[model samples]
Structures are given as C-alpha cells and as structure tokens.
Target chain A: MTPKISQFLSQKNPSTPCLVVDIDEVELRYRAMQAALPAARIYYAVKANPARPLLDRLVFLGSCFDAASWEEVDLCLSAGARPENISFGNTVKKVSAIKAAYDAGVRLFVFDCVEELEKLARFAPGSRVYCRLLVNNHGAEWPLSRKFGTTPESARTLMLRARELGLDPYGISFHVGSQQLSADAYEVAIAQAGSLLADLAADGLRLRMVNLGGGFPIQYRDDVPGIAHFGQVISRAMKIHFGETLPEILVEPGRFIVGSAGVVSTEVVLVSQRGRDEGPRWVYLDIGRFGGLAETEGEAIRYMIRTARDGEEVSSVALAGPTCDGADILYEKSCYTLPVTLEAGDRVEILATGAYVSTYCSTRFNGFAPLAEHYI
Target chain B: MTPKISQFLSQKNPSTPCLVVDIDEVELRYRAMQAALPAARIYYAVKANPARPLLDRLVFLGSCFDAASWEEVDLCLSAGARPENISFGNTVKKVSAIKAAYDAGVRLFVFDCVEELEKLARFAPGSRVYCRLLVNNHGAEWPLSRKFGTTPESARTLMLRARELGLDPYGISFHVGSQQLSADAYEVAIAQAGSLLADLAADGLRLRMVNLGGGFPIQYRDDVPGIAHFGQVISRAMKIHFGETLPEILVEPGRFIVGSAGVVSTEVVLVSQRGRDEGPRWVYLDIGRFGGLAETEGEAIRYMIRTARDGEEVSSVALAGPTCDGADILYEKSCYTLPVTLEAGDRVEILATGAYVSTYCSTRFNGFAPLAEHYI
Candidate 1:
C-alpha cells in the first residue's frame, strides 16, 4: 500500500467502497506545480473530482479554477473561489450556462466554432474568449479525437469573428490530450499556437494569452516525468517558438493536481473461481465501472490496486464491480494480482483515484450507492 | 423514428436529452409475459429501471420484484410490492444489506458461494436460498463471465453448506445470459440445472424451486422472437429436463420487459467534422456513456438511434456526448446515420433505452444532469 493510504487507513476506518481524498497531498501537488511553472497561471480543472472539500482546500490555497459549466462555476464560487479566477473552459456549452456564467461575473470563456462564438456574443458579451487549436494527440494515454479545438485557419477566423462581435479573443488554447505522456506533443502544440499568435499579430489582432490545456500525466502504473520536467519543457518550447514576445501563459492541470491525492478503499465482496478450479479467480469489489471507476473502461487507465493483506502469496485475479450487469467487469484481460489469502471483507486501496472519480460516479446502479467520499 | 417516440414527441415537447418511458408499453409487455409464461412467476428486476413511477405501475399491475439490495427492496416495498413478493437476487451482497433485507421480511435470496451462504445464515437464517449454476454464455449479447454463478460442483457444495449453516437451500438458478439470443442456451442451462436437482435429490435434499434468471432479449436493431417464443421454449425445456417432477418456476426479466418500453430523446449538442472536410461528421449528443448510455461501453449493446428528421437525406456521423472527457464518446467506429441537416438542438430518440439508462446515470459529470425521466 502507498504510505498515503496506509496513513489514511490508520487514521480512519471508512466504510467499504469509499473515496478518501488526502487534502495535504493535494496541497503538496498544487504547490509543486505552482513552483515548477512560476510563469504560468494554474487553473485547476474542476471536472476532475469536484468534491467540495478538495475545491475548498484549493480555494484556500489561492488556486484558480477551470470550470466546464455554469454548475461548476457555482461550485467554485461556493467553495470561495473568485469568479475572476474561474475560466469557463468548455468550448461546447449551453447558451443558458454561458449566460449564467456571465451573470456570475465570469469573463474568460473558450470557443472553437462560430456558433459557440455567436452564443458567447449573445450571452457573455464583451467577455474574453480563447480559441482552441486542434493538435495531433498521438501518444497521449487518453487521446481526444476531434472533440474540442479547431484548425489554425478556423481559429484565426473565430478570433476575427470574436473581434467583429465585440468579444475579446484574448488567447489561443490547445489540449495535447488527457494524460499526455510526450513533452514533444506540447512542444508541437505550443509551436503551432505561437505561429497562430504571430499570424494574428500580423493581421493586427494583438492576442495576449496562450492556454496550455490539461493533459499532464500522473504516475499510475507507469513512470512519468515530474511537474518540473513538464514546466521546463513548456518554458523552453514557448521561448524557442515565440522569441522575445512570450505571451502570458495559463495552465489547466486536472489529474496531476489531484490524481495521487485520492485513494479509493474498496472491499472484496467475493473471491471465487470460474469454470474449473484452475481457472482465474474473480475478485468482486463493492465498486465497479459505474461506481466512479469509469476510467477503467477498456482498461485504458489501470489503477494500482493493493490488498490489505500485504506480503502473502499473490495470485492474478480478474477484478469486477458488484453489479448485476455483466459490463460492470473492471479488469478481465489485464488482471490484478492480489494476495492469495484475500477473501470477502478484505479491503483493497486503489491508489491515484482522486481525479475523475467523485464527479463521474453514477447515482445508483444495481442499488449500489455512488462512491462515498471522505476527506483528511 | 420509432412509432412510440414519434407519438411521444407529437404530444409533448419535453426538454432535449430526456428519457421518455412509455408506461403503457411496459404494462403491455408485462401482460404479454404473463400470458405467455403461465407456469412461471415474473419478478421484475428493479435495477433495469428503478424510476419510482415505473415501479409503482409495476406494483399496481400485480408484479413481483427481483431486488439486488436493501435499497431496491425498499423501492419495491415503497411502490407497494409485498415483501413476500420480492427476492434478493444478487449473489454478492453486503452483510448490512442482507440484514436489512431480512429485517424488511424478505425470505427468498440467491447465493452462489459458501461465503455468501454463511452471510445468509448469519443475517437471514432459515430463508430460502437459490444457488446459481454456471453455464456457457457464448452467444449472449451481454455475456456474464466469472462475475456471477458457480460450477455444478461448487453449487452442490454451497447448497449442502447452506443446509448445514441453517439456511434453506430451496432452489437452483441459472442465467443463460443477458440479451441471450439463442433458445438452445436455455435448453442447455435448464438441462444442467435439472441434473443438479436430481443429484441433490439423490442425496435426500428436496429442492422445491427452479429460477430461470433474466436475460431475455428485446428487439433493437435485430429482429428477436417475441416473449411468447421465449416462454414456450422455457416451458418445453423445463418439461423435457425435469421430467415429471417440475419444481415451482420463477422468472426474472429485466431488459426484455422494459428495454423496448422506453425511448431516450437526446438533442444534438454539436454537429461538426474532424481534420478535413472529407472526414466523417461528428454529432455530439447531450448524453453519452456517463450520462446513462453506459451499455454503449465497448459498443457491447447497440441501441437503435433515430433523428426527428426521418426520411430525409442521410449521412453517417460519429456520435459523442457533450462531456469534455474523450471516453464519453458513444460511437465513433460504428457510426450512425442521421439526417444531413441535423444540427445543434435537433432531437434524436434512442429506442429501447428504458431499462439501463436512468439507473446508470451519473449525478453530475461535466455539469450535465442525469438523464431526466418523463413517464407517459
């Protein structure tokens, strides 16, 4: 077990299938990121584990928020974050949400298409807007394919359109992808953004900001470079591409800020074999794909699981969530090995589940409650 | 569009991205199942769609409930279902849930392991327990692997253990599979269960019940045999396998009875393209995997999608949800054709989404509300 989880379990015996967020670790990660990228303003993405305690702690530590919707804006505001510190980051947003954000004194918003620009012009008039530029997200663990962002030409057009509609097209943004592993991806995306900014400057549109959208990866089962490494790479890329005219930089980091801070303590409901005695043992947990571990879909994001019975003989077991639905199986092909003595009621802590858990949990599936969350 | 959806739209203009459940169709399906399966008692699985309105309707129509947890048992009881008419169907259950169910006067329960039998004995002593038998689910649309059920040898051991532990080992149960397409699957499973019953009888243990667990398929994209066909096949299989000593029959149908009865009306959030003009158009919906269309995970179960602009020019588009998460994508490889003119705010009704949609909805992800249920 990770020292964080071990320490947490020692403090409190939370009920099974509960998410424990260590606020101390979250503050540590936030400070680390802030220290690493001193030039860039960090807008903590709120969509990732939008638990009140985490938000409140971040706010108390002078953190900005990257809100995806009006509801998130309200959450951040309720958590005591200044509206000026919250950016409406989602490009595709409802007109009503845009209006609500505007009413709540949020001025910074993002847009990719003309319709979105039009919506912002109507609802959030005179607000600062960022155009998302589409980039190749080849090596990212969670590659976003043509969901957000626009082409350089489209970005230019949208910016010009924003100016025409009396909206401030203040910056250009690009997401390398979620859990992006390659620093070169950021280098390429930054270079592209720099070129676009220079081009817009040539056209007499003086854009002042560059939003490096979140994708900074955290250690799950794989080794990743520290926040300093990402900061150094991004700083070098911006300097090399933009020359002396380095635009004001903004960073949105979701998973990196909170991923390692949360530990999910789930209980083993059943550990049984299928077909024959020699077949793979299936370990059923109280939580599954629907219960907040939706990231385990397709086994794309493998969480490091540690059984409470540490050091006993280990055997590979196919892990599943306790749901009547067959699709609730978490890991079948990519199985986890638990201690051989592990059985019903044994607790297993799934480390690095802080981000994208609480916010992603389904209300009630198969009568299983959404993952209960506890904070330390 | 399906006739049901068209009729629904014609009557009321509900907000986009809402689930419209045809309670009339639910009643019709229930009556049809009752007419077809005269020997079997139908226990509607509440997990399929635990909307209070549907539960109340089912209860008013004299339907039994197959509850998976205490919450579901409470939902059934609140909907006016008698405690005696509800069965705790989930094999891997929490001890507290078991105790609560027992306290609520639930006597019928299902178990597949010795540990679960012990849990039952401690919490629900003397209650009638059914041991689930493992069977091949090769051709099932939603194949349950080692998550549920046990081998014949294991079932025999568990049943014997149940008796020793002071629990009534009253029946044998087997789920062929959810959305099982073949009638032969039932024949084979029933034969296996019959052999197990005979073996138990030879040991002087008289099992009094046989549970043909849910997995009956419904018409989506492909044509399926009606409820009558499944009923006839099940009846024949029981007669052929059990011979003269047919035990009391019980059926748990989740998807079949409710799948076709509900239609999900989702709006096109955005209709845009990828890298080039030649790339396939991506249609973003108000709902996605997290929004309650979770069955679309791995593209396992396909729901029939129809845009309001039916009979118009058609174009294949990659569908996605409005969430910022890339994994919220519904279909990309298996693209669906919509009216070429379909744009933002255009309504598209997803057929047969009633069963799993509402129950699986996340509370708030990306600030999108759970799919709102509207019953007619």
Candidate 2:
C-alpha cells in the first residue's frame, strides 16, 4: 500500500474487506502516464473501479475515458468529462445502448465486425467508428477474451463497410492484452496495425487515428517494466512503422493508473491448520473471489499480501474467502505463506488492488454484503 | 423453460437478460425430494439462490434452511422460517455472526476446527454443533474446495473439544461436493462418518445426528442419476453403516430443489461469424460470467442454452458475455452448437440457471445491472 493509503487506513480504520484508494496516488500515476507518452492521449478505462472520486480526479487531470457501456459513459459525464472526450469502447453492444450513447453526444465508437458497424451506422449515424483487430494475447496476465476483435482480413472489409454505410472509418484498435508485461507484445501488435493501415491506405482510405487499446501492466507481486519504457518502445515502433504520417495516438489504461493506488483491507475470519490433510494452513478472509477478487480466477493475479504478523515466523498457507462456494478459494496451489501468529480478526492488506476489485464484487453472494469502497 | 416460464416469457415479454422462475416448479422439486429421501429432514441451502420469494415458497413447503451467514439466516427468518429451523452451516464464521444467530434463537451450527468451535462456545453456548469432515471430491462437477471441512481425525478432535467447550457435539457432516453425479460418493462419506461416529461413541459421547450435506445434482445437458437414486443409495448406506443406530438424518439440497425451476432469458447482443478465423460462430449474450453465470468458471456447470432458432440447421459456436474482459468468454472449447441463422436480439434461454444464477451476478462489473430476477 502507498503511504497515503496506509495512513488513511490507520486513521479511518474503516470496515474490513473494504477498498481504500488514495486519490492523489491516482493523479500521480496519471501524470506518470502523461510523461511516458506525451503524444498519446490517455483515455482512462472506466470499467476498472469506476468510483466517482477516482473518475473526478482523472477528469480534473484532463484524461479522456473509454467506456464499455452507456451507464459507464454516464458515469464519466457525471464526473465532469465531456462527451467528446469519451470513446464508446466495447465492440459487442446493444442497439438500444448504441442509440443511447449516440443520443448522449458520444460520437467516437468502436466495432469489430460488419453487424456492429451496421448497428453503429443505424443508431449512431455519422459517428467516427473504429474496428478492433484480433491481436494475440501473448504476455498479458489477465488477457482479454478472443470474443473481442475481428481478424484483420475481416476488419479491412468492416472498415470499408462502415464508410459505405455513412460512418467514418476513423481508425484501428488492438489490445496486446490486459496486464501485459512484455513491451515486445505492443511492438508486434503495432506492426500488425501498421500493415493494416498500409492495406487501408492503398484502398484510398486515410484513417486519422490509432487507438493503442489498453493492456498496460501494473506491478502486483513481480517486477514489471515502467510505463516510460513502454512509452519509449511504442514511440520508436510507431515512428519506424508510420514514417512521417503519425496518426493521433490514444492509449486506454485501466489498471495502470489506479491499480497501485488502492489497497483492500480484509479481516481474517478463520485460520485453521487442521482442515487440509496434506497440510497447508487454510486462512479464510472476509473477502474472496465472489467478494470482488475476480482477477484471482485461475490464480493469475496474485496480490502482495501484507499482514500485521509480517516479519514474524511464517509458514505456507492456503487462502480462501468467507463464502460457501467451492470456487471462492483464493490461493491454494500458488504456495502463499503468512505469519504463523496470524489469526482471526487480524487485518490483511491486499496491495495493488485499486483496479477491478470493488465493482467485480458479487451482490451479496452467500449473504455477504458487497465489498465496500473508501476514497481517500 | 417450463410451460409456465415459457408462457410467462411469451405473454409478459419481459426485458432481456432476466431470470424467470416458475415457483410451482420449485415446489414440485421439493415434493420430489421429500418423496425420495423420506427419512431425511430437508434443509434448503440458501447460498445457491437466496431470493426472498424462493425462500418464502420453500418455507411454505415446511423446509428448514442451511445458511452460510447471519444475513442468510435473517433472510430465512424474514421469509417466515423459524429460528430453530435454520442451521448456521458455514464452517468459517465471524464471532459477531455467531452471537447474532444465537440471539435470534438459532441453536444449530457447523464448524471444522478448534478455533471455530471455540468461537461458537463463547458466542453461541449450548448450541447443537456438527463437525464438517473433508471427504474426497471424486465424482462432483463442482467440487468443494479443500478449504472447507476438516480431516476426519481433526473433526474427531474438534467434536470432542466442542463437548468440552460448552457446545453440544451433535453430529458429523460432510459434502460429497456440488453437482455430485455418483451415488457412491455419499456411500464413501457415510462410511467415513460412521467410523468417526464409532470412535466418538467409544469415548462415550452419544451423537444423535448425521448431516449428508448438499450436492444433489439436476440435469443440465448430460443425463445423470436422479435424486431418487441418490436418496436410495444414501438410505442403504446409512442403514449399513449405522446398523440400528441410525441418527437423525439430514440432507441439504440446494441445486436439485431449484436448478431446473428457473431459466435465464438473454438477448443475443451480437453474433459474428466474421470474427474468428478458426470458424465456430461467435454468439455474444447480454449476460456472461460476471452477470451470475459464475458457475461457468472453467466451463464447469455448462447451462444448456435454448435459442429461438434451435432445430434449424445447427453449427458449433463460441459463446461469451457482453463485458470487455477477456475472461468473460463462456464456452470456447465446449462444442456448443446453435442455428446458423441466429442473430442479434434473439432471445436465448439458459436452462438450469435457477439455483446459482441471479445471486452470483457482480454488482455492476461493467455498468451492466445485476441479472434481473422474476418469480412467476
């Protein structure tokens, strides 16, 4: 946890299993992104912990937004972001949602296939629409589903179809994936997008934008390359590919700007060494997968655990949430060790939990209330 | 969909992505369970789907409840269940919750370890408590995590400790796991419980109850042994193991009583044959994993989806929810087929969603509302 979050937690000592976010830490991360890629406009992805205070701070920093739903678009607008600064980022959309977003003055949109582009042309007529290209999710920890993005062969046709249907074939977008660690992943995708751009340029279409769809990694338990490193790599890659014709660059980051700024305070509900026969102590917390740690699905994004018993004698332990479901087990195979003295009622701080924690909480599954949130 | 739910959906034309439950169907399943396990007291596990109306109907059917939390116990009580009819079933629980349940006149509880038993003794003194035994998950589709239950040896110690700590060492309980397909699973667990019961009896502690915890399966796609088979197998096993000392048998059935009683109606948000190069059609629904189909994690508990275009030239398809997260893909590897003519806005009925669907929905992961629930 950041000092701001740690101090707020100590001072407030809010309810257990609640999220604490340092608003200033959010601004600092936003400024870091601005310094990393000054030319690429940062459109903060709203789906990752869209607490109003965080959005308000991002808006104050003049950050644009990439919203997956009209309700998220409403959240951004309510946070004082202009509609012109918001991008309707999801490809699969309800036509009603498309119309709702269009009527709300959000002109920029994203689509991957002909049906979605047609829906955009019909509902958000004359809007600037971009096609999402199917990129490989090689290095992302929380990689996006292949359900997104059409193949480039399909995207080429969809973009032309968008223009014929009276929508502007604005650009091309590709996500290297979420929580992407390797800078080479972005470089390879940029090369694919550049080839697609050349293919479209030969077809007499001059797309004016290139959305480097969000996949910026945030540190969890492992060391990762800094944002400046990614920024430099992307800058060099774009120049080498596009030559002098640099289109408007936009990067949508959800986890990076806010992930390190938050901490989840959960109380140990039960600690037992006698549960498992093979013998790793099972520690149950007030929060689990259903309680908002959805990213822990597959034991992928392991959060750095800080306990009051840290620096004491430690032993390997299995972790779980306080729900009845079998899937609520947090860490079993990953070999997590906690202090031997840790027991019930002790607070455990899950770090780098700012993004994708609160909103992912189940609505009272097993009768536990939704994970609470606190913005400092 | 059942005749009632289908009629309700056709006549009412409710909004897309809603669960329509036929209340009578629930009662029918309850009656079937009553007939199947005539010797066992039925405790409806409320964690599966704790909607008030369902609980109210189950209460009207004279069903007891096995609640995971005090809030669930409260939900049961608010729906007309007597406090004595509720069991605080979760092994891991907060001391405050124990106090609340005990104060509410709840006298029965389950625990797996010394710490939890100690908490019950302090907060819910003199309560009838059972020790949860960790049984191997052999034939269960949704297996309970090793996080729950205790080693039979640990349970033996905990039961003895319970008697010493001013709590009743009432019985032993074990879950064969959720969606258990084989009747032999219960037989194995019963033999284990019986041996433990014998060990405790040698110590002169006369335990008078044995809980055959919930895992009753309902048909999804593949046919499995019905609840009657499970009932018959359990009855034979109990008689053989206990010989004339058959304890007060209790069976907790969550999914079996309610799984087939409900169907989720979602709209086909987008259908793209153009997206995937490998060529299974991509069907996007208004709802996905975060929208309460969380049982779809790891493609376990695959709900049989019925579409309007079924029986009209089927082809295999990849399915996903409308969220921007990559993990939201529902079934890419599973060979699920749909009509080639299926398109956007078509209603798709996901079957067997009655038990675990609505309550598992994320509060609003991507600005999408919780899956709407309607009981007919």
Candidate 3:
C-alpha cells in the first residue's frame, strides 16, 4: 500500500463501496507532469472522473481541460475554467452539441471527417480545428480501435477543406491509446505527427498547434515509467522532428493525472462455496462492473486490490458484484486470492481507480445505489 | 422487421436512440403466460425494466411482482400490487433493504444462506422464507454462474435454521438460468427441489410453496419454445416427482414478460471502413454497451437488428457504440450485415430489447444522454 492510501485510510472511515480520492496525490501528479514536460501544456481530460470537486481543484491549479462534449465544456466552465482553455476533443459529435459548445465560447475543436468539418464550419465558423491522424495503438493496455481518426491522405483533404470552409486548420492530433505503457508508442506517434506536419507544411499551410492526445500510462499492477521519462521521450522526439520551431504543444493526460489518486473501499457481502464442499469459493462485494468499475468488462483491466485481513492465509476466490443478474460477476476467469478468513463485512480497497469509475456507474441496478464518492 | 416494430415506426417517429415499448405486445405475452401456466402464480420481475407505465399495466392485469430490492417493492406497491402478491426474490440483499420491505408489509422473502436467514430473522420475523437450491446452468443462452443459491445440504440446514430462528421456512426456489433454452434444465432442477422438499417433509416441516425461478426464454435472433411448452415440461416434471400433493407453484418471469414487447430505435452515427480497403465496414450507433445494451457483454445475447433500408443490398459490417472508449465496440466477431448504403442518420431498430435496456442505462458517458424510453 502507498503511504498516501495508508494515511487516508487512517484518518477517514468512509462507507463501504465508496470511492475516496486523495487530492494530495492529484497535486503531486500534476506537479510532476508539469516539471517533466514544462514545454507542453496539460489539458486535463474531465471524462476520467468528472466529479465537481476534482474539476474545481484542477481549475484552481490553472489546468486546461479537454472536453468531449457540450456537457463537459459546461462542467469545466462551471468549475471556473476559462472557455478558451477547453478543447472539444471528440471527433464525432452531433450538430446541436457543436452549436452548444460554440455558443458556450469553446473555440478549439477536433474533427476527423468532412462531415464533422462541415458541421464545425456551419456551427462554429472560423473556430480553430485540429485534424486527428490515424495511428497504430497495439502496445496500449486499453488498445483503442480505429474509432476517432482519419488516414494521412484523408486528413490532408479534411485540413485543406477546413480552410476552404472558413475554419482555421489549427494543427494535427493523435491518441497513442489510453493506458499506453511504453514511451516508444509516443515516439512512433510523434514521428507520425511530424510527418503529417511536414506534409501539411509542404502544402503552404502553417499549423499553429499540435495535440498529443491523452494516453499517458499510470502505475497500477504493472510497472510503468514515471512522468519524467515520458516527458524526456516526448521532448526528444519533438526535437529530432520539429527542431526548435515546435508549435504550441498540448498534452491530454487523463489516467496519469487521477488514476493513482483514488481508492475504492468496498465490503464483502458474502463468501460462499458454490458447488461441492471443495469447490472454489465465490466472494461477493457490494460493488461490481455496473457499480463503477465498467473497465473490468472481459476482465481486461485489473485493479490492484488489498483486503483488511492482509498478511493472513490466503486462497483464490471468484469475485462478483451484488446483483441478481449473472453478468455481474467481476473476476471469474482472472480470480483473486484473498485472506482465507475474509467474510461478510470485511473491507477491500481497490487502488488507482479514480478514473473511468464514477462516470461509468449506472444510476441504479438491482436496488444497489451507485458508488458513492469522497475526496480528501 | 417485426410487424410490431414496423407498425410503430410507420405510425410514430420517436427520436433516435430511444426505447419504444409496445404495451399491446406486453399484454399479449402476459395473457399467453396466464393461459399456459394457470396453476402457477406469475410474479413479474421488476429489475427488468421497472418503468412505472409497465408496472401499472401489469397491476391492471392482476400481475404479481418479484421484487429484487426495496425500491422495486415500492414500485410494485405504487403500481397497485397488493403487498402479499409481491415476493422479495433476490437472495443477496442489504439488511436495510430487507427491513424496508418488511415494514412495507412484504411477507415472502428468499434466502440461500445462514447469514441472510439471520438478517431476515432480525428484520422480518415470522415472514415466510424460501431457500434457493444450486443447479447447473450449462446450456443457457445467458448461462448464470454460481452467483446465487446454495447446495442441497446447506439449503436443508438453512431451512431448518429458519424455522428455529422464528422465520417461516415456507418453500424452495431455483433459477435454471436467464434465457434458459432447454426444458431439460427445468426438469432436472425440479427433481432436485422435489428431493429436498421430500427430505424436509420427512423432518416434520411442511413447506407450502415452490418457486420455479424465472428463466423462460424469448424469441430474439433465434427460436425459443413458447410459454405453453415450458409449462408442459414443468408440469410433467412435478407430476412425475411430487405426484398428487403439490406446493403452491410460483414463477418469476422478467425477460419473458417484457423482452419481445420493446424495440430500441437508434441512429447510425457513422459508417466507415477500418484498416485495409477490403476490411469490414464499421457502423457506429448512438447507443452502445453503456447506453443500456449491457447484456451484449461478450455478445452472449444477440438482439434482432433491422434498418429502415432493410431490403436494399446487404453487406456485413462491424457494429460499434458512440462512446470514445475503445471497449465501446458492440459486435465485431458476431458482425451484422446491413444495407450497403447505410450512412449517418439512418435508423436501426433493435428488437426484443424491452427487458434489460432502460433500467441498466448509465446517466451519461462521453456527454451522451441515457437512452430515452417511450411506452406505446
């Protein structure tokens, strides 16, 4: 356990199945990222954990925001972020949402297709727009599919079309992928961005900004490089490609900023053997995939878990959420070992779950309330 | 397209990404179940779409309810269901929820362990309790894991303990599985329950009820036996095992009551080709895994999909959700073929989605609203 978690648990006793975010850890992460990549502006992605408190804290720290829609832009603005500092990062958006964001004073937007570019030109004319370039995301733990970006050839046409349609062809952007593990992924993506920049420059279009989309990995169960290493790798790539004439560099880091700053405390509802006397024991918790941890879909992402009865004799158990639905089972194939003495009411803490939890929680399922959240 | 969906679309134009429940279909299904299983009591499971309109309609039809939580009990009561007609079906429940249900005059409750029985003994003394027996769910389309219920030995002990603890050990219940396909599954489960019932009878305890828990399959993308066939199979099993003396038979049907009654209308957000030029076409929709179709997790349950341009030239396409998350991709391996000319803003109707779609919807993810529900 990290000292931050130990300190928070020592001071506070929250209700079971509650998410407790350590604000101090958020501050530490933000400062570390800032120190590592001083030349890059950080636009905190609000979708990770859009709790008002975290947004307010980030705003107080003078952090820019990467808003996905009009609602997110409103969330940031309500948290006191300057509208100019918020970028509409989603490439596929409804025309009404585009108008809503433009009306709310959001000037920077992202687009990947001619349809989106046309929507932008009509809804938010003369707004600064960035074209997203398609890149390989094989190494990312959460490998993003070909969902958001366009090919290099298609991006060129879109950028040129943006200028013709009375929208500023601001720059280019690419997401390595969420929970990207290696700095080499950034090197490859940065090199791709560099080539796109050169190609666009050859067409006599001088782009003013480049968005290195959110994908910075955080330490969970696996080892990951620190923010400084990512910064060094990114800085080296930019220098080799763009030299000293680098455009205004912006980085969106959602997980790295808040992933480690939060911890979820849940209680064991039941621990029972299913089949025969010697069959595997199933441990049920008040929280599950629908409760807040939707990322556990297919058990792709594993959160580092700790029990109050740690250091005791342990056995592997299948973990499940407290719901009548059979699909609520959390970790069945990828089972976790808990203290043999663990029983009902025993607490378990899931670490580094601040991001993608609360936002993904359903309103109510099987009479269980949504996961409550607390910030320290 | 199903005639129900076609008529709905032809008569009324609901907004995109909306759930349209045909109340007429619900009435037909309810009446069919009543005609098929006249000897068994039907308790509509409220967890599967607890929309007030449906509850009120079910109440008008003199339907009993199988409530999962206190909130569901309240919904049933508000829908004009008598307290005695409601059964607290979920085995895993919070103590507070149990107390709330008891206070609301709910008498019947289900449990599978000593812990839950004790909770009932404290909160709902003298209340009738049913013990759930473990059963195999091997061939179910949505096969339930070992999430609920206990072994026969444990259940026997629990029932006796319930009698000793001032709680009424009323009956036994078992769920074959959700979307249970085979009649043989029910036959085997009924045999297990009958043996347990006979053993408990030999112990001088008279149990008065047997809950054949809900798993009646509905037609979606494949053929399933009607409610009459399930009733025949169950009746045959009961006659073979229990002979003349039979307990009060009760069935809790959630999906069967509402599954075929609803259709979801969604707009195609984008249709683009990914990877190589010959690769599969990717079709994105306004709704996705988080948007309410969570049962599609692992593509276990396939909803019948139809487009407005259904008769046009068809080609296979990979379907996805509108969310920015990579895991939002809906069907890749089990791909759907749609009109080759399908484009953004075209409508698609997902049939037989009325049961598990609305209540499971999250409030917002990526700033997209939860699925809008409409009853016709």
Best candidate according to lDDT? 2
Rank order (by lDDT, best first): 2, 1, 3
Record all residue pairs in model 3 with backbone atoms less than 3 Å apart, i.e. clashing.
Answer: none
lDDT of 1 by residue, A195-232 (tens): 99889989999999999999999998778888889889
lDDT of 3 by residue, B1-376 (tens): 3476677777888777899887778888899988888888999989888888998899999999999888889889988999999999988777768889999899999988787788889989999999988889977877765678888998888889999999989999999999998988999999999999999999988788889988899987878887789889999999887889889999999899899999889988767663236767888888888888888877878888887788999888888887777777778778678899998778888889999888777767776677888887
Model 3 chain A: lowest-lDDT 10 consecutive positions = A271-280
For model 2, how does the per-residue alpha-carbon lDDT over B1-376 read when each residue is reduced to its tens digit?
Answer: 7899989999999998999888899999999999999989999999888988899999999999999999999999999999999999999899889999999999999998888888999999999999988898889999994668878778887888888898889999999999999999999999999999999999888799999998988999889898889889999999999998689999899999889999999999998876555779889999999998988888988889898777799998999999998889889887999998999989999998898888889999999988888998
Clashes of each: 0, 2, 0
> Candidate 3 lDDT, tens digit per residue, A1-376?
4576677676776777888888778888889889999998999988887888888889989999998778889999998999899999987676777889899899999988776787889989999999988888977878774666878888887888899999999999998888888889889888888888888899988888889988898877678888889899999999998888998899998888899999888888777765357756888888888888888777867788898788999988888888888778788787678898998777889889988888788867775667888887
Cα lDDT, all candidates: 0.86, 0.91, 0.85
B1-376: candidate 1 lDDT, tens digit per residue: 3466577777888886888888878998888888988988899999998888899999988889999878899999998999999999998888888999999999999988777787889989899999988888977888874578888888887888888888888999988888888878888999999889889889888898999988889987778777788888888999998887789999899897788988888877767763346767888888888889887776777888887688999888888887888777787777667788988777788989989888788989987777888887
Docking band of candidate 3: acceptable
Residues forming the 10-long window of minimal summed lDDT in candidate 3 chain B:
B270-279
Stretches of candidate 1 above 4 Å error? A1-8, A202-206, B1-12
- On TM-score, the stronger of 1 and 2 is 2
TM-score of each: 0.94, 0.98, 0.92
Could you give the candidate ranking by DockQ, starting with the highest?
2, 1, 3
Q: Deviation in angstroms for B252 in model 1? A: 1.0
